[model samples]
Target: MKQPNAAKQHKPLWTKAFLLTSLSNLLLFFSFQMLIPTIPTHISQLGGDDAQVGLVIGLFTISSLLTRPFAGKALDSLGRKHVLLVGLSICALTIAGYSYMAAITLILAARFVHGIGWGMSTTSLGTVIADIIPAERRGEGMGYYGLSNTFALALAPLTGLWLMNAYGFLRVLQLSTCLALLSLLSSLFITYPKPPMPFEKPAQRPTLADRLFERSALLPSILLLCTAVCYGGIVTFITLFGREAGISNVGWFFLCNASMVLIVRPITGLLFDRKGPEWVLLPGAFFTIAGLLLLSYAHSEANLAAAALCYGVGFGSLQPALQAWTIARAAPNRRGAASGTFFSANDLGIGLGAMALGALATYCGSYAVMYRYSVLLMVVFLLIYGWCLWQAKRVVRLFGRTSN
Candidate 1:
């Protein structure tokens, strides 16, 4: 009799909290994605040089990176619901301000504010969802939760590009503001338990050392950084690479990539739960390596699409696998810090990769050459992932002998 009620106490993966947070995440990502490609064009329009474009795009991520540790502290101290709503509202304000800006300095300024909001919102949302999900089912739930961003990743850029051509930058940003507002409203509907305190009450105020990052999450976060740098190459230069390779239309590449991601995400998460991270991450690395190599020499639309498929499958699977593992291994009360650590790694990887690979592309004489070089990072990821697996096996063997 108690068993059934015990089950009832555990929320379904698709609880109101999950749905609202996911929808809010979708809206937030949609608004961000809608502006991503257009921002560079806008920078160019403002008479900024290429280096300035890099600064404009890169600074947003820098701000996000800088804010994540503080956001994590806030999420742990404040309620998840409180942090989430405030973050969304901040994002909404920053986006609205973008609609009224034209100068490069103002645009860069808005991006900085938007990054703070973005960092806070994403960190809180990940922590909140980690709260709702049962430990056993975290991988599955996070996989589904990531779909909202996947949908946005698939659709937003096309819409943004279309809108820019048809309605102009101001109009597109106005629409972006509307989407962010919708995110805030959705966040308002979420009801979640306050995040529990991480440890016994301290005798004094927590120090700066105590305020940032979760040590338990650091391993997977570091591993993710390697793969994420590889991803930066694709996100930053895939379109230009396609053009360089004589493929005029690259929209289908993302559509196809999103399709594979949708198909494999749930499956990979299920695999992670049953078999552990090694099985999922190792093969995923190989897929990524193969994809990058193929992308280097792609000529036909078909080869390009194949690269998208392989890379998408690899990234889609490994990303949530890392996220679930990061939070799952964290102390129960420290999910917020775990999430912050995870995303900070993401921001760090993407920002560094974008700049490093951008320079690498210039030195190598083409984006194609740069992607081929990016494979070397994925190779390092494989080595690190292998070490993680070895460590996992050693622990399992140690436990087995102890039990015996």
Candidate 2:
């Protein structure tokens, strides 16, 4: 009887709800990824200058940042279904709207709205996954869930580009809109958990800070931000860097990177659950640093592939580990806020890293040199993590002394 009870306690991670949510997440990301590489080209074709092309991304980022906190608040207070449905509706409509926009300004406006929906939908999806997955298997569950994104990233851009070449831009938008609608449809079937009611008395209303962010999640989120910064530099400039190095086929780098990530993520996730973050993080950072340094000097496809594989291992290990850590630290009621905080930090880091590293590349007169400097960001990540550990130990020691 006791053995049966113990077996029952180990709830399955791959439930129907989890699968539906993951499917929805996969479709959502696939639709969004297909648009990312094509949108700038669309703006350029519509008589927009380079500055306006940049605004297409910039305005979207700003709107997403503005919407995330409120989305988080709504998810925790109003429940997941409402926020998820509203966000998916906005995404589907905005994607369809993109097909009809004639002017650059209209496209930019639509992109901004799309970002708001992106932020809300992503946050809600993350919270829903957290609610459904078994606590003990969270790292493993998140690893599997994130594969949807990895597969989308690897396939969507290529597919989008192919569609654009064959049928033109309008077809791309129509297909992306259809994908968003399918994502929305899949989401409707998910049985969401009830919203976690506040434990505080009615008179004790939540504060502004309470509604905006999860305090317990900040530490791991900071570490995640540092990694995102390095990632931003890579994704933004790697193609240019390859050209600067006299390499023609830079696409191979992403293919190798994605392959390596697919291999390492599940293993790293299991290690994080059983061994601890230190087992994954230190080696992950080392691999990332090695990858960046190699990439700075890579002049051949083989070298580029090697660098990509190394970076893939590092980033693939770090991202899900930090996210699982963030979710683990937060109360059940605050998981939505925690996910929002995690994503917000990631967005802030990427935006800042791109802008700052672009300036560095300009100043140094070489994208290769810019990558060399980007390694410093990862170094900072390791240092900050070490300091956090020391602080934790010191507080523990002081408490022990006081008790004595």
Could you give candidate 2's per-residue lDDT for residues 1-404 as a string of tens digits?
A: 69976885587988999999999999999999999889998889889998999898889888887888889888888899999999999999999998888988899999999999999999999999989887777778888888899999899999999999899999999999999999999999999988777576547677898789988889888888888888888888888887799999999888998898888888988888777777888899899999899889899999999999998999888888888888888888888899999998888888887899899899999999988988888899899888876776787798853110
Best by TM-score: 2
TM-score versus the correct structure, for each prediction: 0.93, 0.95
In model 2, pairs of residues that clash are none
Which candidate achieves the best lDDT against the true structure?
A: 2
What's the lDDT of the predicted structure labeled candidate 1? 0.85
Q: Indicate the residue-level lDDT of 171 in model 2.
A: 93
TM-score of 2: 0.95
Looking at candidate 2, the ten consecutive residues that score lowest on lDDT are 395-404
**CA lDDT of every candidate:** 0.85, 0.88
- Model 1 residue 208 distance off true place after TM-score fit, in angstroms: 2.5
Q: Residue-pair clashes per candidate, as listed?
A: 0, 0
